[model samples]
Structure formats: C-alpha cells, structure tokens
Target: MTPSETKEHSPMQQQAQTFGYRLLKQDGAARLGEVVTPRGIVRTPAFMPVGTVATVKALTFDQVKQAGADIVLANTYHLMLRPGAERVARLGGLHNFMRWDGPILTDSGGFQVMSLSKIRKINEEGVRFASHIDGSRHLLTPERAVEIQCLLGSDIQMQLDECISLPAERKETERAMELSLRWAARAQRAFSDLAKPGQALFGIVQGGVDAELRQRSAEALVAMDLPGYAVGGLAVGEGQELMLRTLDGVLPHLPSHKPRYLMGVGTPSDLIKSVARGVDMFDCVMPTRNGRHGLAFTWNGKVNLRNARHADDPAPLDEQSSCPGARDYSRAYLHHLVRSGEYLGAMLLSWVNTTFYQELMAAMRLAIAEGRFNTWAEETLDRIERTN
Candidate 1:
C-alpha cells in the first residue's frame, strides 16, 4: 500500500493523528493485526527486510515491494556515520531519498553500538564510540538517538538503550535494564520535542535472558505507553528455548493494543514460535546474508546451492513458487553461478530468500485469522526447518 508524503501540521494536530494499531483477529496468543501509519498499512506478523543503509542488499526497492513487504528497516548507526542524519533530512528525509513510499523503521543504533563494546565506553549519558568506517568519535545519547531518527523522518523510530550480551551476571543485566529505562524516558522527551506528525517512537525492552528482568523491563516500558515496544537483546547467542521462555515471561506485561516488535530475530521457525507468543513484527539479516552465501529459503526447507548435489539438478529452487527468482531458474544453473562467484547468483538468491520470508508471514497472518495458528505452525515448522 503506497502512502502519501507527510504534511506539515501543528503539534496538537499531529498528536490527534498519531500512529494507530488495530488487532483484527487472534488465535491463542497469535494475532492478525495492522499497524496504521500515515505512510502505509503494515500487515501484522510482518517481516521487514533489513535495509540497513536505506537499501536491502542485492535487491532494489521494486524487488522488495514485489516480495510483498509492507515495510522495510534501516539502521541509524550506519546512516548516521556515512551520509549523516542531518544530510538525509536536508535531502528530504529517508523516504524521499530512498524512494520507498511504504513505511520505514529506523533502529536506534544501540545494538550496533553494543557490538563495538571493545571500542566504546558506556556511561549514564550514553555510549561514546568510534565509527567503524573511519574511527571518527561520536557520542550516542538517548536524546541524540531520538533526534537522529526524527531527522531521518522514520515512521517507526526505536528508543536508544544499552544491550548486553547473553549469559551476563544478574547485576550486569539489571544495571543495563535500569539504564535503558532511564534512557527510554529521555528518548520519549526528545521524541516529543523533535518528532513530526505521523512519526512514532517505540521503546525497546532489554534485560538479557533473565525472565524476571525481562518482566521488569517490559512493565516499565509499558508504563511509558509508547506507540510500540520491541523485545531486544534476543538472538544474541541465547538459545531458542531461553528466548521463547523470556517472551513467555515478558509479553503478558505489554499492552495488547500496541504493536510488539522482536528485534534482530530469527529463522522461519523463530518467527512462527514468536508469533504464537504474541509478537507482531520482526527484522533480521538472515535471509539476504544467507542468500548472498548460496543459501536460499523456500516453502519446503533451506536450499544450499553451493552443495555438489545441486550441480546437475534440473529442478528449479521451487517450481511451485510465485517468485521468478525462485521458480524460473534451475538448481544446476544457480549452483554453477554460485560456484563461479557470479554476482547474479547473489542477486537472484537474495530475491528468492526475501520473497520466501514474506510468504511465510502472509501464511501466518492467514492462519492466525482462521483460528488455526498453533496447529498450522507446528506442522509448517516441522516441514520448513528440515534441510532440503
């Protein structure tokens, strides 16, 4: 669904026309819903392709849109480093610059900052880190993070918070969680000051893998009553079981009406299971990253094109698939291209993998609306998790 450009409005007018979330249906904890934004209608159980630097790797916006994605995610850390947030705003914001009319979400860059812990210092104000690009120094405070996203004109903006690695001490986890809560408050205040009409700021829940800390984090963010909440700090070496268990403990505390986003998660199986636990949105680099390496996702299971078995196979990746990238090319050809290090191989596989992800989300939305998500998820997971 194409959305019109943002129109200038008074703060009171913008507040009256803020972002909305509507739950259309539910089966068990799974939901069929819509995130109503000025940019577009993002279908619930949506998989936003990771457009880290305002573009999905190896695919154009047309290809992404054709893959049935209602929204795409961009990174704050990367853009702020390279093109600069102020530069983007001067160039008519991210949507105009990128030419994607659909809704766009900008990460707060906290996770990327966390990954550079060796080169960064974290304190009450925020993290001071050197840019990976050129080692330029910059301080990323909660207020600054919110300001960057507002400058980028993101429809859905994330709060800046500290994210610790898994298997951390309770004291460490508690410290980071409490710090994130304080940051969330500052982020909200900054968002209030800078965010334009139709722009929304989402708070992220961080507590590592501890359920008690997860609940505490969720509850505090819930009290803030942001437009959306994200379960961050998962899929960072935490096993699937622990991640799911963490969701079990924390999701109940989040308001049902607002959208719940699971950050940087996961496989197809992860999406299905998380949907059963009440997550509404997701973003990850798995599909494109795996695709660029000769792995493609499909309805049946994972397909490794670099494998010798596919070198002479006459079959397409999926003859039943609607995506031409998946349905029109033979496995033998893809195997040759991948083995030969052809760029076309990466491009086609990225397209196939992304389309497959969108298809999975669509199927889940339908099943949730039909009141059979649990049954459907179990059977589908058994099929898709198996290697082809």
Candidate 2:
C-alpha cells in the first residue's frame, strides 16, 4: 500500500490511537508524549524553531535536526510571496524543496496578512492585502490559505482565522472574535474537503483577552472536532500575567484528546508558564533572533555577549551545555567575534540559543515526568534570574 493508505497503521496512528498526546509519562500537567504525524512523531512540550521562509536563516537542515528540533514552523505568507506555493509544489513540496524530511507545520498566513502587510481589508469572505516585500496585491481567504498549505504538503496545517490585537474595546474584540470564528468554520470545511490521509488540520481559537469570549471561541472550534487546537492572539502585546491568565481561561475548554498549541509566544518564562497551564506545543523566534543580537540564554538567565567583563573571562558560555558553541567556545572569543562583527558570531550564538531552548524543553518534560515540575520550574527561574 502507498504511504497514505498505510497512515492508519503507521506511527501517526499509534500516536492518535493513544490520543493526540501519547502520554509516555506525566508530572502534573507537564507531559512527555509523542505527537504522531505522517512525516514523523514529535515529542511534547516541544519547541518548534521558526523557519519564516523555506530556511531557518543561517542554519542547514542537518544542523537544525542536530540541534534537536522534531519539527519546524514555516510561514505561508513568506513562502507564498517568494518561491510561491506552486513552485514549492513543483519542487516536491516544502520537505524536498527545503531538503528537510521531518514534519512541518505551516501557519495560515492570517496573522501576517493582518500585521505585516501594508494595506489590508478584512471581510467575511477573506482578506485583501499588499505584499510587504514588493507591494504586490493578493487575496487570502480561509479557502485560499488551506489551498496554499495543501500545495506545500504540510503535515499539520493551521486554519486561517482573524488575529486581532489586544487592549482593544469590548465591541471591537467581540467583532474580531466573531469574524475569526466564521473564518475558522470556512477554513475547516475547506481543509476537510482537501485533506489527504496522514495530513491534519488544526483550528485556532481567537478572542483577544476576554475570558468569556475565549471560552466561547474555544467551544465553537472544539465543536468542529479538528485534529488539534491553537490559542492565538495572546502574545501580541499583552503582559505575561495577562497572557497566562488568558491561556488559563481558554485551555480548560479545549478538548483534552487533541494537542494544544500556543502561538508566537515568548521568553523562556512564558514557555514554562504556558506548559504548566497545559500547552503541548510552541513555536517562536526569540531564541534565534536574540542570539543573532549577541544575547545568550543560560541556566543562569540571559547574558549579553558584548559586555566588557567577557573580554578577560576564560569560561565557556556554559560548561555543562551539550551544544559545542555553548560548551567549547570561550566568553572572550565570543566577545571578540561579536565586537569584530563577524558572521560566525551570529551563527554560533543562534545555534547555542536554539540548543538551549531545546534543552529547556527536554528538561521541562523530564521534570513533569518526575512529578517535580513546580519545584523544577521555580528553581530554574530562580537560577536564571539571579545572574541575569
């Protein structure tokens, strides 16, 4: 039988049969589970590195896997703009085009269409906007977003839903939330019609910061019974406390049988907090972006590599780090590279930060399995905050 025909007996089925979260072990809400997909299985409490375009900026696919990423997120907005989804499809989809065989999750471009585009008009039908790259005009509706992800052959595709900014009036938030729900329904219908075996679609719940509205949105999406769910619109501009509270409000309403993803959030603290609140997956660019700026994440908080004190320090970034850049490179050498404006500086730091982020996720999973997540989290944060 072909791969699609055998998908039910494949690892993806094994994971799904055990529930979207195949609980290998659990420590409180923290869990170590496998998220089965047609491409491969991803470990829970996982951190997916952001590959905005086809590539993960400066790093090779092999290097990315070596850094311990089970999956990576690609932007539909960027890819559709440049290489065009059709070109990627002609080159054998994103996996072969990008030369990475692992599973990939593609965002619906809804967020970018609203935030990055120069001109945008949103209606029940879809969104019309000018491309940020060259001011090219394009229309992205729920159906179009689904179609683009299908062309890219993503293992997991997100529904195109409206994402509104926070701290807005009640009426505006409700209007945006209602629009997102309607778009989500259309996206789901489109996804179901086109979904091939081994591919899954995730519904997004959007309500800005309103708890009642968040619950309403979650209830509406859950009723459709998509493969998974994502909590969006929290990390846009809200403070950490509010973000966590919003998650707390919506997570309980999400179906437990499916995976829960928190979109575009945050610092290390945000990750820990959200995981404790029962988030299963996350994707962010902080690690790579911050790394490129000479910042490093260590067990002892974030360190700026450009500091003068590092000029004479002989210690590595972290002696116990499994990553070469973190364990083998000295503070003095890294500082010199940063000061000299060498490209290697950004590359090494990005690698280290990526490694660190993965390591942090692994540690959280372990702590959860050991039933010491709270203790571990507190201690970890204390250590990081002390020296930062």
Candidate 3:
C-alpha cells in the first residue's frame, strides 16, 4: 500500500505511543528486529546510506531505494551550511526538499563542527565555529541543534554533543564527556518542549575510547530515556580492534530495547564486527567515496578498476552479483572509463558498491535470523580477505 494509504499519526501522537522494539531473532550477539518509526518501520541490522548533502552523493533517491536502504542519514553540518536548515523547512522539510518520503535520520552537526570546521570553541552554552563553506560564523547549542532538526522535520534527530578526538588525554576526554552529558540534558529538554508527532529524538553517547567514560555517558543518556541511542566518537581514527573494544565497553550500558547506531563507520569487516557486538544501525560514506575512486568491494575481495589486468577483460566485475553494474558491465569497459576519467564509471561503480553493501547487510540480517551469523561472518570475512 502507498504511504498515504498507510495509517498516519501526528509526530506528537507517535512520540506519546509507548516506544517498543522487539528482538525478532539473533545469532550470537547479532540481532534482527524492527524499528517502528512514525514515518514507517525499519528492519534492524539496517544500513543507512550517507546522504550528506541531502543526496546520496552520486545516486538519486530511487537508486538509493533500489540499493535496499530503509533509511538515509543526512549531515546537519552540510545542510545547515548550504541551502540552510531554515530554508529546507521553508521548502517543506528534508523529505519534501529531497523528494524522498522514506525515513531520515539527521545528525546533530556536533561531530562535523568538531572535526570539519575551523576555530571551534566549546563551552557550556554550545559550540561556536566558522562555517566550513564560507567562513561565516554560527553558534550551535543543544537547543539550537534540536530546533534545526525539528525545522527539517526529521523522523530521527540526534542530540548535540561534544565529540572529542581520540589520542586525547584522559582529562580532556573526561571534560568532553561531561560536557556532552550536560548538553544531552539540554537537548532532551528542547526535544521534549518541541515534541511533535511521528518524529523521535536520539541521544549520542560519547567518551572517546575510555571505557569508564563510555559507560558514564551511556548511563547518563539512558537516564534521559530518549527514543534511540547512538555510539559516537569511535570511528574517527582508532583502528578496528580499538573501535570494537570500545563498543564492547559501551554496548552493555545502552538499553537493549532501543536501536543502537554506530556513527561514521566503516569497512565491510567493520560492519560485520559491529553487528556481532549488538549494533543495530550504521551509516558510512566508504562505499560511494571509495567507489568513485575506482575501488569495488566484492565477495571475492576488493577489485581496483585502474589495474591494467582489466584493460581487455570481457567478464563483468562480478558475474554472480545481482547489481547490473557488477553483473553486467565488463571489467574492461569499467577500467577504460575509470582510467579515462568518465563520470559514468563512478556512477556505475557507486551503484554497484551501494548494492553490494545492501546485499551484505541483507545477508547479515538473514544469518542472524537463522542463528548462523557466526559461521556466515567467518566465511564472508575469509572470502573477502582472500588475495590473489
């Protein structure tokens, strides 16, 4: 049935409804479930493609839909910089502005402000920074962050929190964590006051890589009882093992019934490992970004289209694949386009990468549901790690 035909409720009504998340199945710590949002239901173990600038890089909304994404993540930092969040709302919110009626989750812009902007100063009130786009000044507090997301009419909104860079001193991490907790409280208040039907607010747990700090942040955010929770500040520069260890440290503190999102991660191996650690949602730019650079991820391993070996090859990138870019286009053609700097090369490869990523998530969901995720993960990892 069409979305219009489906039952509709005001955002506030949906928020008032007791938020429920049921574990449908599991394989080890990996889980399969559904997140019933006011916009719609999203199958857990879901991978939200990054639509940083209100678009999923090279692909259209329909193409993203075909890639098997149940939700798309937009960057508040980018959107607020250009076009402007207020402008987007005036144009009728992100869904209408982007022409994608499906569910959307918007980051609080804190991460980008910390990592991407220049001269960022953090205080009790909020962060003040020069815009990365035009060097214009802007202030983003917890309340202002919520106000922006509300204006964009996001289905899932994140609270503004400080994300400390790793390799940080213990004292620095503690300071950031404490500040984030205070901001989370302010964000909670803002969200409560602006509560609308169908939309939900999420609080992010931040602590760099310190286990104690992570637990503290999680416990504090949990106290606020947000609809969902996200594990942020992990994938910055820490290696995979460190990130997983951090997840192990933090996951136990988060409520099992609420959806757990791991922000800005990662490689295929990373996704599998995070799922095994009980993470339920993810968003990353690796697939599209790497695809544009001529890298293709496959079950057999990564293939570089710039290699001369594919110059005369007649076989598709992967004949056994379902995506047209992977199963239909000859390697030689892809190589030529990529080497010649043609736009279609990036488009096709990006499409394939997206499809592959979705297929990987689908396989993971099925494996967990069937209680064989461990075996599936091992075999999948072995195949991809194979070289020559």
Most accurate candidate by TM-score: 1
Instruction: List, residue by residue over 1-388, the lDDT tens digit for candidate 3.
Output: 1111211122222322334466788777898987876666677788899999899888988988877777899988888888998999999999999988778999999989988897788899999999987899999999999998898888899989888877899899999889988988898889888857767888888888889989999998998888899999988888998999999999989888889999999889999999999999999999999889998988788999999999999988778776789899999999999999999999999998898888788888777877888998897888776532
What's the lDDT of the predicted structure labeled candidate 2?
Answer: 0.84
lDDT of 2 by residue, 8-54 (tens): 11124233322244667766666667788766788788899999998
lDDT of each: 0.89, 0.84, 0.85
lDDT for position 279 in model 1: 96
* TM-score list, all predictions: 0.95, 0.94, 0.94
lDDT digits (tens) for residues 53-126 of candidate 1: 99999999999988888899999999999799999999999999999988899999999987853489999999
Off by over 4 Å in 1: 1-16
**Which consecutive 10 residues in model 1 have the weakest lDDT in total?**
1-10
lDDT of 3 at 185: 87
lDDT of 3 at 68: 73
**lDDT at position 151, candidate 2:** 95
**Candidates 2 and 3 compared by lDDT, better number:** 3
> Between the candidate structures 1 and 2, which one is better when assessed by TM-score?
1
